[model samples]
Target chain A: MSSLPDRRLLESWQDPKAAPYVRIERLTKKFGDVYAVDDVSLNIFQGEFFSLLGSSGCGKSTLLRLLAGLEYPTSGRIHIDGVDVTDVPPYSRPVNMMFQSYALFPHMTVEQNIDFGLRQDRLPRRERAERIGEMLDLLKITPLRKRRPDQLSGGQRQRVALARSLAKHPKLLLLDEPLGALDKRLRENTQFELVNLQERLGTTFVTVTHDQEEAMTMSSRIAIMEAGQIMQIDTPTAIYEFPNCRFVAEFIGSVNLFEGKIVERQGDQVLIEAQFGGLMRMRSFQPHAIGTPVMVAIRPEKMRLCETPGGDGVNRLQGIVEDIAYLGDVSIYRIRTGSGLLAEMTLTNIQPRTEQALTWEQEAVIEWSPTSGVVLTE
Target chain B: MKRRSWPLLSILVFGYAFLYVPILLLILYSFNESRLVTVWSGFSLKWYGELLHNRQLLDAAWLSVRIAALNASVAVVLGTLAANALVRHGRFRGRTGLELLLTAPLVMPDVIIGLSLLLLFVTLQQTVGWPDGRGFSTITIAHITFSLAYVAVVVRSRLARMDVSLEEAAMDLGARPLTVYLRITLPLIAPALLSGWLLAFTLSLDDLVIASFVSGPGATTLPMVIYSSVRMGVSPQINALATLVVALVAVAVVIAGLSMRRR
Candidate 1:
């Protein structure tokens, strides 16, 4: 997991005077009539692990391809390290890409595959061998150097692909679903290793991934995209805890959204008159006019079993547990409220399941503080 | 294990016999001591020794081999280019028309192709003052015209199935387009190239109608010689030549199969 403290130290994007290493200005890519990347402008600082997070066909991969110079933008310009590389071919650009398929040349051995880029640059034979040796050792794949791609397992092939792409020592690297082919256990382990590799090498990395957890675990900042446009761009914690819009809130993680209209405003909090017959108070920084329609987005874990039922009716709801999923660490209760809305709440399994207090069809009351959820206008 | 059915076994046996019986008979009679191919007096190698010493038959066979080799080499280059254009360049302008033109030779009758190529060569000779006599160069060109189509068909399927990312990955790692094609693309599609080259060589070697249509004086190929001699009379020497051809083809097939299995 990427803790907030670790990311706070690497927030170069927060510095107003920091210059971006990779700057994409209003980039748009059209395949025939459909816009794959539509006027998307973004800036990535040097040494930052940036991720373009989206579902398949949402243009995250297309955007990464544009950065790699694999796909030319239909409009706008791309600048890498203060140079306009918009019109440069992929080979001429100072960048390398790891394809999602791990496109290792089937005819070549691991050593030859890693040596391909070095040979292209016409490096000296001795230096080429040295670089190849370093890459094999760095990726811990020296034993498989003589083996062809078909002889290697999926994980080994992935390492070979990574070593080959990194052998040239490009300033920036682009990865398209780098860990996508691995199984669940391997993927989780590789995620941390990949982040550590990027940190040690100090190479600016831009990765495209559909898995939100992978993005959250690795990226310094994530750009959430939808339908060829970015919905939000922020740190993982900020994006999860305080999404600017309903789509980002729903897309990142499971959140219970209560549609409402603002009826009251305090110093820094606004009271929402929910459609489900409740007044929900939430902290807000964005200015909103009275009677403006909005939504209060709250995570399932933020809601808790109410201790005082009659204290306040502001953020309290009465419901009957319809289903209980007994996960080892936590149990999720899907409760049907009085207004027929299914409200989900996850509680840590402190006691054994056999002695659990709440069961199916049991009446329960849940409550949350005003600062627990954000008020979204869109 | 399930027992095999009698009817299915008989059908399989009949199918193999129908295909191989003529080849088997020809091979068996190649060793016949009798002058008549229908009768076998005793096993002998006399015909093979005489066939090797025959000057005209040997000359014609040498010419055919040279023409087939040259034609296969040239056809492989041109056909591979066409396959690359079709498979790598995604649906360019006039793609459908080019595809139709490339495939037309596959369906066109051999006689029609031979006649059309003869006409083309004659016109080019008169107007462009090239291919002065329809001998080696002209015959090879004619063979290439039709052989290229088959080569293109074989190479195109392979090029289509190849992962385009391999080339892209090469380019991404600082290899230029030409270097990427040479190192990554060509090596990956080499099996298809080899098979295509062999196919073109076999097609050119065995072709009779096209060679007859375009060949001038003193430019007779092996098939033309074999056809003319068979028309004159059944020669035991020709039987020996046919058996040698069959043996060469069998050795080639075995080698190809073994190489494919190794990969």
Candidate 2:
């Protein structure tokens, strides 16, 4: 896990004067009539592990390809280290990409694959061998150096591809769904390994992945994209906790939303006339006038279920437990409120033996603090 | 396992016999001591000895080998380039027309291709005053032109199946287009190129009608010699020559099959 203290230290984006290492301004890539990347602009600072998180056809991969110079943007500009590289070809760019499929050369041995880039530059024989040896040792692929890609397992091949890309020591590295091919356990293990490697090397790493958890776990900042456009860009925690819009809030994690119109505004606290015939009180630092239409969103983990309503002033609802899912670490109770809206509440299993604590059809009170929910206008 | 069906087994047996029995009989009688065709009085190596001493047949066989080897090598090179252009370079001018021209020779009748090529060669010799005599060079050129089409098809299919990202990855690692082609594209498609070359070699060696049209005096190929000899009479020497060709082909095919299986 990335420690909170280091996160704060690495939060250089908060500084207004911090220089961006890579700047993409109004970039657009069109294939025939379809825009793969439509006027997307972003700034990535030096040494930041950034991610473009989106599903298929969302243009995240296309954005990364544009940065790698694998694709030419139909319009706008790309700047890396203060140099404009919009028209630069892939081979001429000071960037490298690790393809999702690994794309290891079937005919070449692992060592030869790693040495290919070095050989292209016509490096000295001794230096090339040294760099290849260093990469093999770093990636723990020294034993498989003599084996061709066909002879290696999937994981071994992945490491060979990584070593081949990293051996060149490019200014930036772009990874396109790097761990999408791995199984669950290997993907998780490799995710952390990749983050640690990027940290150790201090190279600017920009990865594109559809997996939300992978993006959250690996990147310092993430850009959420949809339909060839970026919807939001922020730190993972900020994006999860204080999403600027409904799509960001919903895309990052599951949320219990109360569609409503604002009824009262008292400082940071606001009362909403929810659509489900309930008056919901929520608090936010963002200012909103009375009679504003909004949706109040609270994460499932933020909501709690109790046998009886609490005495404290908090949002509460009477509901029947429609579904109970025991997910080992936590139990999710789907509560169907009296107003016919289903709200999910997650409770951590502190006691392992409490399997039947909340049974189906049992009446329960779902409650949450005023500050736990964020209001979404979109 | 269940018992095999008798009907299917008989069909398989009869099919193999129908295909191989005549060839086997011809091979067996190639060692006949009798000079008369189809009369196998005794097993002997006299016909093979006579074939070794036949200077004209031997010369023609050598010429055919040289032509076929050149045809396969040149076709492989040209076909690889054409395949790369077709598969990698997207939407070039006259792409459809180029594709149709390349594949036309594959389906065209051999006599038609041979006749057309002969006419073109004679016209070129009259107008451009080059290739003055139609012999080994003209025949080799004709074989290469047709053989390249088959090679291009094989290499194109191989290039299509190949992941394009492999070449992109190479380029991302600072390789120029030419370097990427040499290091990545060529090696990945090497198997297709090899098989294409072997096919071209075999086709060139086996061609009779096309070589007869393109060939001139002092450049008679093995197929032309064999065809002329068979027309005159079915001699024991002809049987021996046919057996030698069959052995050569069978060995090449077996080797190719084994290599494919190993891969």
Candidate 3:
């Protein structure tokens, strides 16, 4: 599959002159005294595929429902294509949603299911038939046209749902955990297909998913949500490389955080006295004064294990390998440092079969580059 | 395993026989050549022919069919509305009270239901000068009142089991609420409605107590005529009528089961 063009090259959210296609301002929804979505403001550009990423009950799905007009906001305004649709009913809104259940009409055949939206719009009969034909071909389900939803497999049902939602050609498409029901392999394949489809159609797509890998792979940008609020929003790589706070860093991927206080500051490097990992020095662009408590967050793959001591132990430590997890393409090692902190490291197993490797309980030196980790304040 | 299954099989056979033997005997004796019910000299269709010639029983049977059909239709419409309100309306005012009132007749004693309905019709006639005198309309109304409970209970369970997202998906696809109900919700719950209607029809057709209490002199239903005839003596004509009723119910049940499978 060809790689998708990076829509984030024009970071329009940062540019004041660029107009957003869909804008939500101060969106909040409450269910009896508890807020499901709280004061979320976001701008999605045309043809951009954005994902709201969070665990269950974190308000990601609720936000998507608000965009689809499935759920009314308690206090907010939503504008699609410059028209306010906050109070518009779902049937009147120019947006379609692919439900998590797929929600294919069990009584209708695949073709009939895809044609339902077009029929609801009162399109002419010929045009409705043509659109349904196109959708059948696009989703590669022409052979299953005569079969009801119950006859199709999970992945086929999902494609049919996608085809139905897209057949209407709405200004925006909302997906609620679109691939949540598929097996791992099908989910991985469908993710790229969804991105490609969005690119071809040029419709602004907003998807809600708890799978961080899916969001990182398909979304032009992702919003990390926590407790009914957005914690961070950025391109996937940016979010992974430079999470603004502890929650964003931990939520996106696995990380080893060393809680410490800054003891000394040099030109661009700082010396930190970590409570568990001992004294360490690292370079960061983030500016923090001396004696400020902070977290040094480093991804598992960023750390390198060595058989020998390296250069006076700056950004390095001697630790015993406590455990080893041998995944097919890579091996993850958990190391217990002399200071009693366990640091996890992932390494690609590229060596030949004849080569020996470090086993559990062996002492080794683990080191990372000075610029490899980020400084988190919260 | 043999020891365990043997007793279980015996219980199953005994249960079925206990339930079906009387109906089987009635059907068999309906064709008995002898006048004595216990003596089956030979099979004959004389009683069925006699039943065809009795104008009173035929008229009563025809009236029962009409009332049951009308009652089933009215009960289905009203019961579907009640079921939707109970299942879809989230925590509305008096929801629990309305639910209790709708389902109470399902478990309420038939004698109490009949007497209460009789009183209600009498009061309505005296106060509003309506329902001039109990006849076809009163019998149909009474049947609908009790049948509504059974239909509503069946439809409510069905509506509850349906995924709410299906309707929401239709709405998101630009179907208005009414259109969604027609295109998605109705089709999904049709089987339940069919079974509910069939149940209501059978119940109304077989009812004697409620019909007896609410019915006036001119509207004698099939069950009332058959009961009065049997109170005098067990006639072969009554056995023939009972056999026909059983056959009709079996056909209706088979149709219902087949339609459920199609879904």
> Highest TM-score among the candidates is held by which one?
1
TM-scores, one per candidate: 0.96, 0.94, 0.96
Candidates 1 and 3 compared: the better one by TM-score is: 1
Q: Which candidate is the best by DockQ?
A: 3
Worst ten-residue run, lDDT, model 2 chain A? Answer: A1-10
A1-378: candidate 2 lDDT, tens digit per residue: 554325454466777888889999999999999999999999999888999999899999999999989889999999999999999999889898899999888778899999988988899999999999999988999999999898988888889988998998988999989998889999999998998888888899999999999999999899999989999999999899988899988898899888999888878888888887767888867677778899999999999765465565347878899988889888888999888999989889887745457788988887887889799888
- Residue B74 of model 1 has an lDDT of 96
lDDT of 3 by residue, B1-263 (tens): 44568888999999999999999999999999888888889999999999999999999999999999999999999999999999998999999899889978888988898899899999999999988999999999999998988999989999999999999999999999999999999999999899989999999999999999999988999999999998898889889999999999999898777776676
Off by over 4 Å in 1: A1-10, B125-130, B257-263
* lDDT, candidate 1, at A151: 100
User: What overall lDDT goes with each candidate model?
Assistant: 0.91, 0.89, 0.91
Chain B TM-score of every predicted model: 0.95, 0.95, 0.96
What is the lDDT, from 0 to 100, of the residue B127 in candidate 3? 98
The regions of model 2 sitting more than 4 angstroms off are: A1-10, A306-314, A352-357, B1-5, B129-131, B255-263
For model 1, how does the per-residue alpha-carbon lDDT over A1-378 read when each residue is reduced to its tens digit? 543324454378988888999999999999999999998999999998999999999999999898888899999999999999999999889999999999998888999999988998999999999999999999999999999999999999999999999999987899999999999999999999899889888899999999999999999899999999999999999999999999999999899999999998998999889988888998998899999999999999999998777965998888999999988999999999889998989999999989988999999999899999999888
What residue pairs clash in candidate 3, if any at all?
A: none
Instruction: Tell me candidate 2's fraction of native contacts, as a decimal between 0 and 1.
Output: 0.91
TM-score of chain A of 2: 0.95
- The iRMS of the candidates, in order, is 1.1, 1.2, 0.7
